[model samples]
Target: MPEPVTLRPRGGMIIAAIALVIAAAALVFIAIDGGLLDLARWAWPVVLLGWGAWLLYLRPYVRVSEGFVEISNLVRTYRVPWGDIDSVDSRFALTIRTRGGRVIRAWAAPAPGARQALSTQRADVTHTPGDDDTRRPSDAEGTASGDAAGLVRRELERHRREGTAAVGQTALTWHPLLIAGTTALAAAAVVSLVLPHG
Candidate 1:
């Protein structure tokens, strides 16, 4: 079997990390300057930054293995077998349509802009028809969605041709860490608002 393929947005992750650092610094500054009360007042913006970090850095990944494709898009992880995937679409993001008529979107691989998409198409045409491209085409990480989508579609086709369909159940798993973090943030915000200043 080939090595597992992981698809994620390279640029977004870096940007998110930078933003997270900046937000954390601001949080620390606020807490230090005026205590918890001042920090609490501006917590909403910090919370928004955290959510952005969660979306860009923590969540949204696609792992395509020989057996199945595991997609974690923010809150839930979807596991779908190769046989169940009808098609992989890249209209906005990487979306998978299952033979069972279920649609799953991958948050990690965002669709490229029009200019980037065009350049990718040009790149595809420039390659010799007979010469195979060694690199796995990706949409979110500087690679175009068209190439990434085509690669995935071809993989699915190859799996079908080889009769490699296994009995895999389509499952969705929630991210407990994300849920707990959100809950904690909300609780802190509420406590800050409700309790009188000491």
Candidate 2:
């Protein structure tokens, strides 16, 4: 069996992380020049931005293996076996429909903008054989959603070709740790706002 393939928005994540690091450093410098209360005030925005970056960019991903496709969302992860997948769509994002009629959207892969759609050549959108009439403008090959769908569809086709496809159930799971961490960070931000400054 081949290794699982992980797909996500690397460029955006890198940029967001770098920007946050710079902001955080600046915050630390400003806090050092001021009193302790000023540090608390500066802390929240950094914490908030860090939380946003962690949840929005660093966390979400789609992992495709020989047996299943795993979608890691904000606070939950869904594992859909190849056999359980009824169809995959790229209308707005990399959306998967299970045989049990469950729809899961991947946050990491979003469709392109108007300008991007307009710039796509025919070669960029020549995806696996499927209905073209329903295909949208942003469903180009280079777009996030389109590329992710391609990876999933290709994997699904491989299973079909090897005669290993079947019907199964999609599994859903939540991350308590993620939930707790997010709540804690949000509370800190709120506390910082309400705290009396000297």
Q: Compose the digit string of candidate 2's lDDT tens values, residues 135-192.
A: 6655666677877888888878878889887567888999999899888888888887
For model 1, state the Cα shift of residue 69 in Å.
Answer: 0.5
TM-scores for all predictions: 0.73, 0.89
Best by lDDT: 2
**TM-score for candidate 2:** 0.89
Query: Please, what are the lDDT tens digits per residue for candidate 1 over residues 123-185?
Result: 543442112343223333344354446556667777888898766668888889877877777
Q: What is the TM-score (0 to 1) of candidate 1?
A: 0.73
Residue 184 error, candidate 1, Å: 4.3
